[model samples]
Target: MLQVGPDLVCIELKGVNAYLWTGPGGPTLIDTGMPGSWSQLVGDLAAHGVKPGDLKRIIVTHADFDHIGCLKALKAQSPALVACHTVEAVYVRGEKSKPANPSVLGYVVHPLMAGFQRRYDLGVWQLDELVVEGHVFPEGFTALHTPGHSPGHMSLLHKQAGILITGDALSNHKGKLSLPMVLATPNMGMAVESIRKLGGLTYETACFGHGPPIVGGASQAIAAFAQTL
Candidate 1:
């Protein structure tokens, strides 16, 4: 786990990542890592002296299997309320599959993943809140409705902490900032648009789902990347 900002910790779960923020409101978890990642999630929380039942909230960035994988188990173990964008709630509740990509890859890849997607649906989970755009939490994160990776994907910004959690709205995979994988994103154009939206935000440190945190001048780096797009 890496100290992100103030009380925030970036917990690396195998390949994916989750975050733990211990604040005045108690513990808040952002994302839950890949399915069956419960053990690792638990270990990370324990490192911070937190338990599953101690979590105050679980903010979901999107409904992909990897991101919400341990959500079901974690929620069951804790009283933590689950919050996600309204559009993403459908998929989180096992109501609908992630929309297909608008690219040629989606034409082939989505079809093949149909069976796996259904089998992997970690849903039918209950949502305690809807965190739409401009919504602010006591923990200080403002929800940014930056859709692209998924229709309801939302990155979070803790203005007070100067930290931005880019939940696959874009990636810093291999320490390089870039748009989310094209095949995984339904609309590449919309994804680019989302990056532009993030560029408008002010943040000093940026953390991602797949890479190390960019600790300084993160927003400037993002703005530079946005210009490239």
Candidate 2:
């Protein structure tokens, strides 16, 4: 676990990351890591003197397998309100399975990948606490609709803390800020557009779902990366 903001702790589970928001109106979670990552998430919460049931809410950036892996289990242990983009609620409810990435490789690779989740039977969930662009969360964040990776992919801007929780709209993998994996993203075009959207924002720190946080000059870093797109 790593402290990325005044009230945010980054919890890395394998290659993906989840965030714990400890600010006012919080004890909220940003994302949950892959399936079977419940123990890891529990450990991080414990370090902060929090338990699974202590969370006030669980906010999902999107409905990816890696991101929503432990959401159902966590909710079973805690009555935390599960929040996600209104557009993605169907996928979360298992009413609709996510579509394959609109790429040649994706057509072949995505189906093969579904097998992994099938083995674990990650259940579906739905919630009415939906989000939209500019929606202010009670935990003090302004929503940003950043699509392409997934239709309802969202990011959160914590203006007070000067931080942004970038949920795969951008990745700083290995210290290089760039777009998500080509195979993982459904629409490269919209992803680029989302990067441009992030560039226009003001934030000093940026946390990612797939990489370590950029502590300072985060907005500048994202802005610079967006120009190259």
| Per-residue alpha-carbon lDDT of candidate 2 for residues 24-79, written as tens digits (9 for 90 to 100) | 98899988889989888998899998898999988999878788888889888997
What is residue 215's positional error in candidate 2, in angstroms? 0.7
lDDT values for all models: 0.87, 0.86
Model 2 regions lying over 4 Å from their true place: none
- As a whole number from 0 to 100, the lDDT of residue 114 in candidate 2 is 61
Off by over 4 Å in 1: none
Per-model TM-score on C-alpha atoms? 0.96, 0.96
lDDT of 1 at 47: 90
lDDT of 1 by residue, 3-77 (tens): 877788999887788999997665999999988788989998999999999999999999887788898888889
